[model samples]
Target: MKLTPLEIKQQTFEKGLRGYDVADVQAFLTLVSNEFEHLLNKNKELEHEIEKLTDRVKHYERVEEALHETLQTAKESVEQKMDGAKQEAKSTLQKAEMEADAIIKEANHQRQQIRQSILRLLDRREEIINGISSYLDNAKKSVNQFSKDDMGTFKLPKEEDLEESIDKVTSKSSYSRFELDEEDLEISSYEEEDSAFAPGSDRLDDILDEID
Candidate 1:
């Protein structure tokens, strides 16, 4: 039968002619019962302490697991962000390089156009200078030739006489812008064919060819 501390303390023994000593047995039983009760109480306290310690250990384990998961998630997020930043930097660099190249190309094209315009302006300036030089040379020749020709008296010639002289000289290759009307042709000259067909006439032809 199961025996509790109280049951052991209250147990009784049958009387006998040669049984163990009653006082000694009863005293020993009482002592054993008190010691058993103390041991049971101590065991119960130890069990409760073990249960509390186990709960504490389980809680710490859960915290450690959560911390590990959080650390891993943070690591992944940082890596992803780093990758995105690198890609963005690369794209931005490429765009900047393309823009710089385009600007350089445009600048080069503008420089080429400016250079061409300068060259064309220089050619036109040279052409104008040559034309002016030729005109001056022809004017010098015509003046020298007219000085050699025999001029009449210091008086001006009549309009009809001037017209007749101009008609005889202008029978060859013609010129523009030098068309002398009645008033403009009132210059005195010798009435001879050789005087009319002198260096002045040839110089005039040269001037007209240059103009043409």
Candidate 2:
């Protein structure tokens, strides 16, 4: 049913009255077959080239898809790493803040303790100073009373009597200028020998020694 180039070249026409010239018709048929065969070969070449181009396009599409997937995976991995780093940093920061707060609290507590100790020391010093001041005031009052009593009751002997009394008692015994009451006279005479005792000098010394 289909006519190839070879079939067209080999075709023949039946002889009849007023029929075309056989040689001319055969020559034309040969020329048409050759031209058609050339056209067919060119179409086949074009089809082969189109098939090669199509295969290349499919390969390029596969490569592009693979690149897209790789990029997406890389982006996700980067985001995950960044999030992890952020969380670690936040945790570290919180820990540092807590530690700092604890240190500050401890320091404040120590400072309060030190302050309390200083206040207690100051109070104790004040108490000691007050006790000493009260003792000294009482001692001063006792010394003043003793001086007034001595001035009122005691008298100095004459220079001639004093020299004679000193010579008389030099080898026998010592004497006190003070005349004590009957209850204290014996003890005072035995304990005290200095007739030149000043008003508050020896008495003040005794009181200070007692205090000590």
Candidate 3:
């Protein structure tokens, strides 16, 4: 049984012949009971302080875990955004390369067309030159065929036959340089005629016979 300080002070033993001193024991017990109550109250206060410190420690641990989780989430978001930027840059580079290649191909095609046109122009110029050369040759042959005899020698005009005829024709108007040279050659050949007609009037008549 627990003893109160008041109960310990109240209890006293009577001392008769040869009995121990009971009053002194009761007073000492009262003092010891009061000291024990004081010690128990102080121990209870220390236990409450320890419990509160433990709760604070638990709260701090949970906060540290939440901070770590938030840091990891932020790092993951940054990495994902960087990867998307790299992909977009790669696609843009590829598109630029394609555009450059298309431009080169178009330039090559235009160069080929220009080369073909130049070749065609050269070929057409050659054809025109050949046609003009043929026409000049034919015109030279026609000039060789002109004859004083085909026009017929003048009948009974004078002794100097071809010169007199050319003079009469030119008196109307002047003839070209070719006709003037022909008349000069015929006037030089007046001695070649014996009967009434000459065998060869001049080299002009000879040239006319060769042409016919």
Candidate 4:
């Protein structure tokens, strides 16, 4: 049967001849019951402490597990962000390269167009210069032939004829500013002044100088 501290203290024994002393035995039993009760209380307290310690250990284990999971999640997130950043950088670089190539291509095309325009301008300038030089040579030849004529007095060409010739020569050139008009010719009859027709006359020389 299960025996408690109270039961042990309350237990009774039958008396017999030459048995133990009653008072002494009763005293020893009381002491043993008290000691047993104290031991039981101490054991109960130790068990409570052990239970609390076990609960704390379990709580710590759960916390450690949660921390480990959090760290793992953070690591994965960082890696994913890094990968996204790398992809973005690569895309940006490719776009920039394409833009640079397009700009360079456009610049080269514009440069070529400018070069062609310059060449055309140079050719046009040469044509105008040649036309003006040819016109001046023809004018000089005509003037020399007229001076060598056998006429007694030097006769100037009619104003209308001179104007027509000038118009034809100036039409092929861009130097309109150099064109001469009738007002600038100052042509008149030389019959009154025979010296004007002389070989060493300054009048003819002055006309030729004005033409030049």
How would you encode candidate 4's per-residue C-alpha lDDT over 1-212 as one tens digit per residue? 76678987898888999988989888988999999999889999999999999999999999999999999999999999999999999999999999999999999999999999999978876765665566556556656755675874467889998899789887876677766776554343343244334343334454455445
* Tens-digit lDDT string for candidate 1 (1-212): 65678988888899899998989989999998999899989989999999999999999999999999999999999999999999999999999999999999999999999999999978876875676666567666756765663666556889999999788778756555567776545442233444434333445555455446
Once superposed on the true structure, which residue ranges of model 1 sit more than 4 Å away at CA? 1-3, 121-212
Per-prediction TM-score to the true structure, in the order listed: 0.54, 0.51, 0.37, 0.56
- Which window of 10 residues has the lowest lDDT sum in candidate 3? 193-202
lDDT of 2 by residue, 1-59 (tens): 76789988998889999999999999999999999899888989999999999999999
Candidate 4, after superposition: displacement of residue 128 in Å?
Answer: 5.2
Error of 2 at 8 (Å): 3.1
| lDDT minimum window of 10 residues, candidate 4 | 192-201
Clashing pairs in 1: none
Sort by TM-score, best first. Answer: 4, 1, 2, 3
Q: Can you write out model 3's per-residue Cα lDDT over 61-171, one digit (the tens) per residue?
A: 788888888888888988988998899999999999999999999999999999999899788667655655554565455445432346555345556876987778778
* Model 4 TM-score, all chains together: 0.56
lDDT of each model, Cα atoms only? 0.79, 0.79, 0.68, 0.78
Candidate 2 wrongly placed segments (more than 4 Å): 1-3, 117-212
**Error at 210, model 4, angstroms:** 26
